[model samples]
Target: MIKVSVLYPNSDELIFDKEYYLNTHVPLVSKLLGDSLKNAQVDFGLASGVPGEAAMYVVMTHMSFESLESFQAIFEPNSVEILSDIANFTNCQPQLQISEIQI
Candidate 1:
């Protein structure tokens, strides 16, 4: 399994719309990634620690590294288009990390 964890730094003005993100933005990305994607998770509405940190974090879990490959292959300028859909709500770049599950 491969997990891509994105930590969003909270900002005063950039706080994401929880329902919009959950209902719209997330589904857009998930749809692009396709049904092959699995264990898709989104977390929001959290208390901030640092003043500059984002108010939310989103973690995407692929069934395996294979899914990651599929995702990257399709990633491109279209990514920018897709990103623009949610850009206004987030201030930090998605810090994606792929890690193998040891379980």
Candidate 2:
């Protein structure tokens, strides 16, 4: 399986709309991606390993797919709409990573 991680790094100046992300953005992505998306998980970071450090990211979304081709087929087509929705939620530019999921 392939796992795609969308990470929103945390910073002192960052603004993240967790409510919209959980309620609106996630569903929008799920609806757009359809069956090609095997599973989706969202994480809200609370803190870093260090006691007083802020969490690395404010939010991270993990998506599982059968293959990169399958993910791209839907993502590439609907990316415009999906990306545009970000402005309605947060101003943070998300970081992305793709990896192979083992077991």
Candidate 3:
């Protein structure tokens, strides 16, 4: 399996609407991606390892796919529409990474 990680960095100046992301945005993604998306998990960061440290990312939405082709097929066609939805939820720019599952 392969995983696509969408990481949103935490920022004092940025605004993220958790309610809209979870309720509206995520569902929209699932609907658009369709069956190509095997599964998905959304992580909400609370803190770092330290007692008083900020989390590197406020949100990480990890999506699983059977293969890169499956991911690309959906992502390539709908990237514009899907990506544009970000502005409705958060102001922070997201970092994206695609990784193979070693374990």
> Best to worst by TM-score, what's the order?
2, 3, 1
Is 1 or 3 the stronger prediction by TM-score? 3
The clash count of every prediction, one per candidate, is 5, 0, 0
Q: Write the per-residue lDDT of candidate 1 for residues 1-103, one digit (tens) a residue.
A: 5665554544454544567766787777777766545656665535447785544544232333345666566555358766687665555565556666678
lDDT of 2 by residue, 1-103 (tens): 9999999999888888888888899999999999999999998999999998989999989999999999899899999999999989888899999999998
Reference-based lDDT, residue 92, model 1: 53
Candidate 3 C-alpha lDDT tens digits along 1-103:
9999999999889899999999999999999999989999999999999989999899999999999888998999899988999999888889999999878
Query: Which candidate leads in lDDT?
Result: 3
**TM-score of model 2 vs. true structure:** 0.97
Tell me the deviation in Å of residue 85 in model 1: 1.7
Please give the range of 10 consecutive residues that has the lowest summed lDDT in model 3.
66-75
List lDDT for all candidates, in order: 0.57, 0.93, 0.94
Q: Rank the candidates by lDDT, best first.
A: 3, 2, 1
Worst 10 residues of 2 by lDDT: 11-20
Of 1 and 3, the candidate ahead on lDDT is 3
Candidate 3 lDDT (Cα, 0 to 1): 0.94
